[model samples]
Target: MNSRIVLGAFALTALVACKEKENKNIVEEIIEIEEVQPTTYAEISVKEGGSWKEGTREYIDGSFVNVDEMEVPEQHTDHSWYIRYEGPGWENKQTAYRLYLDWRNAIDIFGKKVDTLVLPYVGTDGFDSYHNEAPWGQDILKAGQSMGIGGYGRFTGDTIAHFNEVEKTHVKVDNSNSSSSVTIDYKGWKTGDVTTDLESVISIFPEDRFLKAELTPSVSFDGLATGIVKFDDIPLMQETSETGEWAYIATYGVQTLAGENDKLGMAIFYKTDEAKAIEGPHDHLVVFNPSTKTQTYYINSAWDQEKGGIKSEEAFKKDLQTKLSELDNNGKLE
Candidate 1:
C-alpha cells in the first residue's frame, strides 16, 4: 500500500510537470539583465594557474557581476579549486570555490595560495540534452559525492570551506573571449567507500524555472523500496512532444557503495537535435558487464543510421573492454 501510494504520487508529479508548456523566452526568465550590452573581456587571476575569459555587467544592486560565463583555458589543469577576482582582488570582491585566510595554511593543503582555488563546475544546462543535472539543477544543494570536508562560509565569512583540516576558497574572473569559465581538475579525494547514498532528484540539464524529468541512475534508498535497483545504465533519451520540440531528460547518476566499480560505462548517442516521435527506434545503447556492474551508455551520433542501435552493441563492448584495460593498467579500477 505504501509503495502504491508513492508510485501514485510520483506519477502525478510527472503528469503535472509535463503539463506546463516551455515558454520560449527562457533566457529572459533567467538573466535578470536590465540592459543587454555588447560583450567585453577582462583578465582575472585564478590562483591555481587557471585563467578565465570572463565578462562583467552592473547588476540591479549596483555591484558588477562576473556574468557567470567564464571559460577555463583548454590547457588549464592541475587544481581542484577555482577562484576569480572579478571586480578586484580578494580584499575588494571576488568569487571562489574554496577560500580560506590561513592563506599559507591553504597552500600547504591545496599546494597553492588560499585565495585562488578552482573547483570543478560542470553543468548540462541550457542545452536540450544536458539541462537537468548537477550544475543545472536546484536539487544539487550539496555534493552527491562527499568528503571529510565540511562547512562553507564559516569563519572570516567568505565562500570558503575547511576540509581535511585545510581551509579552501574559490574565485572567478573574466576571460579574453568575452565569455566566462573556471578550471579545476578532478583530483584529490578517493572514490569514497560509503555503502549507500541517495539522490532524491537527478537531472542532466536543469532550468531554474522548469520541472525537468528526474531519474535515479543508481539504486537508491527510495528506489529500492519499489524493487527498482541497479538503474545505472538508463539512457537519457530526447523524445519529442506534440508541441514541436524534443523534450524529456533523465539526470542524476547514483551508485551503491559496493557497486561503484561495477557501474562504469559510457553513454553513446547522436549529437543532433532532430526531433523524433515517441515510437522511434532506440538511438542509444548502454553495454555493460552485469556481473562486474560496469556499463556504458552509447548514443548514435553519426549520420549513418545503419551503424547505430543495438546492432553496434558488439563494437561498444570492444570499446568498453579497451577502456577497462586502460583503467586497470592505470590502477584506477578496484
Candidate 2:
C-alpha cells in the first residue's frame, strides 16, 4: 500500500527543401522569428488554492501570478526535512513531477490537476513531509525496471556505480522553449572510483503523458542507466526494435493513483542508434550504451484515474506503442 504511482510520463526541428537551399538567404530574411512558441506552460503554482490573483509574487517560482513561477522566499519557509528546495517542477493539465534535494533523483507524483492550474507549493502552507500526497496521489516512480528509480548511474562491463550521496543540488525552471522544462543538476558526487556530475533536463509539453530527458555526464563513462521502479509481483513487459534502433520497457496494471492495482503505467524509451546494446546488469536494468557521453531517453508514468481510462495493461501498451513511434520519428520531416 506504500506504492507511489510516479506518472512523470509526459522538442523538435525544422525542415527545408533542396530546391530552397539556394534561397536560404531570402528565407532567413523573410522568417524573422524562425519558430513557433509553445502555447501552454506550467506557469502557475499556488499555495492557497483559490481564485488566481496577483501579489508581490512570493517566490521566484511564483511567476504568471496565477501559477508556475519561481520566486525567492522572503524567509526560509521550506520546512521539508528530507527535501530542501521549493520543489522546482513542471506540469500540464494531466500530471506533474517535482525534485527532492535529498540526494535521490526520483520525482514526486502529483496526479490530476488538483485545482486545474494551481499546485499547492509544498513549503508554503507549512506542509513539510515527504512525496506522499495526502489525498492527491502517492510517489509514482517505482523504479520498475532497475532499482535506480530514474537515478543516474555508471555501469562498467562488470560493475555499477549509483551516486546516492549529495554534495549539493541545483534545481531551476525554464520556459524558454515550446515546453516548460525543469532542470536538475546533481553535482560533485562519487560512486566507487567514478564521480558523476550529471545534469537532467526534463521537458513536459502541453499535453503529453511522457517527458523527454536529456542526460549529460560531466565525465566520460561506459553505459548510462535509465530505469523504472521494479516491482516483483506486478511483472514487466519490454520490447526492442528488431533493427536495434530503439527499446521500449514498461509496466501496467494495479499501479494506479490510489494504489488500487488499477491501470498506471511507467516506462523508459531508449534510442539505440549509437548504442552497443540495451544491456541489463540486473533484472530491473534498462541500460543505454550510447556512442556519445550524452544519453537521451523518454520517461513517463500514466494513471488511470488521472486521465480517462489508461489504467489497464492493454490500453497502456497501445499508448506506449504510439509514444515509441513518435520517438522514432522525432527528427525527420514527413
Candidate 3:
C-alpha cells in the first residue's frame, strides 16, 4: 500500500511538470513568432550611410530625409519602413544637424548618383545650432554635398589648417569662376591629432567671381580628412532663363561621439569684370556641418542694379580682406 501511494504521487508530480513545460513552450513559441513578425517582410535601403544624423536608417527610393532630426518617414509600402534617429544633443553634448535633398531633384542635377554626391559629416562650434524652417529656402545644400551647378563647372579644394592664435582645425575651400584655375596645397593633412597647415587656391574667369570658405573644427575620431570636389548642375537662381552651375567642395573629419568645437571663416574675391557686371545677389561663402547640424552661409547683399554703379569689385575685395584680417588676428589665415 505504501509503495502504491508513493508511485501514485510520483506519477501525479510528473504529469504536473509535463503540463507546465508544455504551457511554457507554447508561450515561447508565441513570443518568437511575434518578434519575427514585425521586421520579417520589411525591405529597406540606405542610399547613403552616415549622411543623416547618427541613427538614421533608411532613405526611400527618391525622397528627402529631414536633416534637423535625421528622420525619414516610413512610406506606405506593403513590407518596408525607413527611419532616422537623433534628437536634441545627438552629436556629443552639442545639438545634431543634417543637410537634406530631394533624391529625384538631385539625380536630375548629377545625371546619376555616384561616389561624388555626398559630403562628409562636419562638427564645429561657430556654426548656428538652430534649424531651418523651409526646405525651399534650404535648397543651397544637400545631404552629403554637391559642388558647382553643372553647366559652367565650379571648383572645389580642401585641406587641414590650424588656427595658431587659438587651438583649432581649419578646412579651407576655394571656388573660382569658369575661366580660371585653382590649386590645392595638401602637404600637411594628417589622420591624427597635433595641428598642421593647409591651403586651397581657386582661379576664376574675368566674367565670374570666386569665394573662399573655411571650417575650423575639433573632431573626436582618429582618421584622415577626405576632401571632395564635385560639379552639381542644380539651378539655384531662377530669375534668368539660365540653369546655373555650382560646385561642392568638402572635407570630412573622423566620426566621433564626443562633441567638437571650432569656427567657420570665408573670403569672397570677385574678378574685376564679374564684380562690375550687375547680377542678382549670391552667397559668397557656404559652410555645412552635420555634426552641428548647421550651415554658416555668407551672402553679398550689396548688389547694384545699375551696371557699374556699385563698387562691387572694391567692396568684395574689402570684404575678403577684412575677413582675412580677422582670420589673421585669429591666426587662421596662412
Candidate 4:
C-alpha cells in the first residue's frame, strides 16, 4: 500500500511538469521577430573594390543589401571631361549630389530626380544641339563650402581654401549594406599649412531627409565650418548651445528646387562637447574645438514642395527643436 501511494505521487508530479513545459512551448511559438523589409537596392560607382572605368551598373537583388545604391539612379555626366567619371557622384530615388572630382574640393548639387533632367536644356556644344538638361540644383552652394559641399576646407583665419584639399584617391563607395553610403578619402586636408588627417564617410537612406557625415581625424582639429550659400534676400535662422557643444543653422526663404523663387530650407547640424563658437564666415560656419579624433555631423535640406513639412519660419524652427529632441532621446518612439 505504501509503495503504491509513493508511485501515485510521482506520477502526479510528472504530469504537472509535462503540462507546464507544453504551455511554455506554446508561448514561445507566439513570440517571433518579424523580418525587416527591403527597400530600393543599390549598385554604386565602380570605385567599390572595383575599377572606375565602368559607367553604369545593373541592379542586382541581394547584390546590395541596403536600400540606397548608387548605380540604380540616373546620373548625369561630363565624360567629355574625363575617361571615366569616378564620382563620389551619387543620386537616390529623390535627389542627386555629385563630386566634381576635376573641378574643386566642392560637391555640386543636382537637386531634381534624374528623370526630370531628361528633358531639354541650355547651350549645346560645338554640335549646337541641346547638350543635357543641366543639373537643376546647379551648384546652388557656390563658394558656400570650398571642400565642395561638405568637403573639408582649411580655415586660414581668412578665406577657406579647398583646392587640392582631399586625396587624389578615387572615391570609394559602400552600397553593400541595405543603406547606401559613399566615402571620400583624405590623409588630412590643408588650410594654409595646417592639415588634419581624416577620412569622411557619408551615408544616406531612402526615407531620410538628411545625410550623416562621420569624420575620423588622426588628430584633433578645430573651427571646421559646414555652410551654405547666403543670399541677402533669404533670411537665416538658427540657435547655438549655451554650453558651446552643439549648433544648428538654417536658411529658409527663397531657396528652392532649382533655385527658383520658391521656398527651400538648407541646414547643418553638429553636437560635441568640443564645440567652441558658431560664426558666420564667408557664408555660415559652425566652429568646433575638437577634444577627440572622431566627429559626426549632419547636412540636409527640405523643399516646401518635395518634403511635406515646415514651410514657414515658425514651423521650421519648431521642427528643428523636435529633431534635436529626437536625436537627444536616442531616436526613441516619442
Candidate 5:
C-alpha cells in the first residue's frame, strides 16, 4: 500500500510539470506573434489653436491636430491650408495615399522608402514638406487636371466632373492592426443635371500597395468612372485576368513628380462585368455600369525608389499579373 501511494504521488508531480511546460510554450508563441504583427494607419488632421478667419475661407495661425471625423467647411478648396496634407491620409507598410478632399477630389500617392507606418509623421513638419523627397518618401504623382489614380467622377462626355458642387462633405477614418480606411460622404453631389449622394470608402490592408475603393451612390446614373492620371509618352496597358473575371488599366513610365527619371506605375483593377467601357481622352477611365449598388475597384502603385520595390516595367507587369491571378483564384487579393 505504501509503495502504491508513493508511485501515485510521483505520477501526479510529473503530470503537473508537463502541463506547466505546455503553458509556457503557448505564452512564448503568443509573445512572438504580438511582436511581429503588421500595422496600418489612417488619419485626418485640421488646424487648431487658431481661429478661422471670420467670413472668409481660411484657417489662420494654428498647428494641425488629428481628428477622427470632420465636416468640410463651406469655404474649402484646393490648397486651402485648413486640412493637413490637404485631406485624410492612410498607409500600410508598402505605401501611403491621400485625397484632395476639396474641389479636385483627386487621389494621390506617397511613395514610401521604409516598411513601417509613416503617415502620422507626414505633413507634420509642414504642408509642402512632403512634396520634396525625404527619407520616408515623397508625393510621387502629379495629378494635374485628372483623377489621380482610382479617383472617381461623373463622366460627362468630353469632361470628368469632380466634386465641385457638393452641398456638404463629411469624412471619417478607421484604423486597426490589420487594415485602415477612410469614409467620405458627399451629400447632394451635383454633376451636370443629375444630383445624388455618394459614400466612398477607401481601405488599405497590411501587406500590399493596393487600396480598395467601394463607392455607393444613393441614386443610379450613368457615367460614373474612375481612372489613372494621364502622362505624355506613357502608354496605357490593359489586360484581362486568366479567369476573365478581373481586368486592369495601367500605366508605367517616368511619370512621378519625384523627377523626370523616377519611374512610377499606377493601375486600377475592376470586375469585368461591372465595367461598362474603358475610355480615355483626358484620363484612362473605367466607366462602371449604372447601378445603385456599391461598386468596388482597386488602385495600386509601385515606385522604383522603394525598398525592395519594383524597378522595371517588366517586373511591375509581372507583379500585376500575380495579383490578378490571386484575385481570380480567391475572388479577392489577400
Candidate 6:
C-alpha cells in the first residue's frame, strides 16, 4: 500500500510538470509570432557625398543616402533629383505615399501590389524609375498641378497656393511597430499678404490605407484647405456620415499614371463644422475655417490591383460608408 501511494504521488507530480511545460511553449510561440510581424516605416533618402552647385539648383556627384531628417535646400524643386522619389515617403503594408518636399508640396501615392515594406528599394534604380510599373508598384498619381490626394494649400478664391513662398522647410520621419509618420514644418509661408508658420503631421497605421493629417498653423487665417485632384472624366461624390460630424469628397475612375486601364479611388474625410466643401480649378477642395488650432483630416486610396482591393465603384462606396460609420461611432478610426 505504501508503494502504491508513492507511485500515485509521483504520477501526479509528473502530470503537473507536463502542464507547465505546455503553457510555457504556448507563451513562447505567441512571442515569436509577435516579433516577426510586419510594421510601418518612413524615410528620406538624399544624394550624399556630393555638393550643391554655387549658382545653380543642382546636387552634383553624389550617391543616394537615407536620412531621418532634412531641411529642404533652397534650390530643390520638382525634377531637381536631389532627393529620392523627390521627398520623404512613408508606408504600411497596404499603401505608400511621398511628398514632393519642394515648392510643389504635393502628396503622391504609391500603389502596392504586395503587402510588404517596399519603400527602401523604391527609386533606388533610377531617379524616375517609379513612374513605370515594377513587381512592387509605381507612382500611381499624376498630381500635375493639383494637390494630389490630401495635400494642403491656401485656397486663394478660385485657385490654390502651394508652398512656393515658404522661407524654410524641414521634414522628419518617425516609425514604430504599429505606425509611421512624417512631420513637416513650413516656416514663413506666404500667401498674398498673410505669412504664417505651419506644421503638418501625416501618419499611417499598419492595417489601413487611410493616412491622417494634422495641420496646425501659428496664426489664424482663412483659405487653409486640402483636397483630391480633379479629373474631367471622373465625377466627384460627397456624403456625410450618419452622425453628420464627418463628411468625405471622393472620386473614382481610371486616373492612375500606371496605365489607362488601372482604376483608382481617392477620398478626403473632414469634419463638417470645421470645413466647407468647394470646387477649385484643379481639385475638390475642403476649405477649413479660420482658426489657429490644429485641424485634422484623413486621406485614402484604393487601387484595383491591390490585394483584395476595392475593384468596383460600388464596392469602393461601400467601403467608404463603413469607414464613415466607424468614425461616427468611435470618433476615430482604428
lDDT of 6 by residue, 131-150 (tens): 99999988999898999999
Candidate 4 stretches greater than 4 Å from native: 1-80, 83-86, 90-94, 113-149, 165-167, 240-245, 256-260, 307-310, 331-334
Model 6: runs farther than 4 Å from truth? 1-37
RMSD of 3: 24.2
lDDT of 4 by residue, 67-97 (tens): 1223212232334222122244444444445
The parts of candidate 5 lying over 4 Å away from their true place are 1-38
TM-score of each: 0.19, 0.65, 0.21, 0.62, 0.88, 0.89
Say which candidate scores most in lDDT. 6
RMSD of candidate 1 to the truth, in angstroms, is 22.7
**Per-residue alpha-carbon lDDT of candidate 1 for residues 1-334, written as tens digits (9 for 90 to 100):** 1101221243444444444536435344323232222122222323432234344211111211223323333323223123222111111001111212112111100111112112222111221111122222111112121110111111111122222222122223323222222221111211122122112111111101111111122321111110011143544433322332222222223322222331212222211132111211221111111121211111111010111222243454444344334333542211
Best-to-worst order by lDDT is: 6, 5, 2, 4, 3, 1
Error of 2 at 177 (Å): 6.6
Error of 5 at 60 (Å): 0.5
lDDT against the true structure, per candidate, is: 0.22, 0.53, 0.23, 0.48, 0.85, 0.86
- Evaluation by TM-score, superior candidate among 4 and 5: 5
- lDDT per residue, candidate 2, 190-260, as tens digits? 76666667777777776766677778878765567766555557677777654556777776666443555
Give the per-residue lDDT of model 5 (tens digit) for 189-295. 99988999999999988887999899999999999999999988999899899879999999999998888689999999999999854666769999988899999
Better of 1 and 4 by lDDT: 4
What are the runs in model 3 whose C-alpha is more than 4 Å off?
A: 1-136, 141-314, 332-334
Point out the higher-scoring one by lDDT: 1 or 6. 6
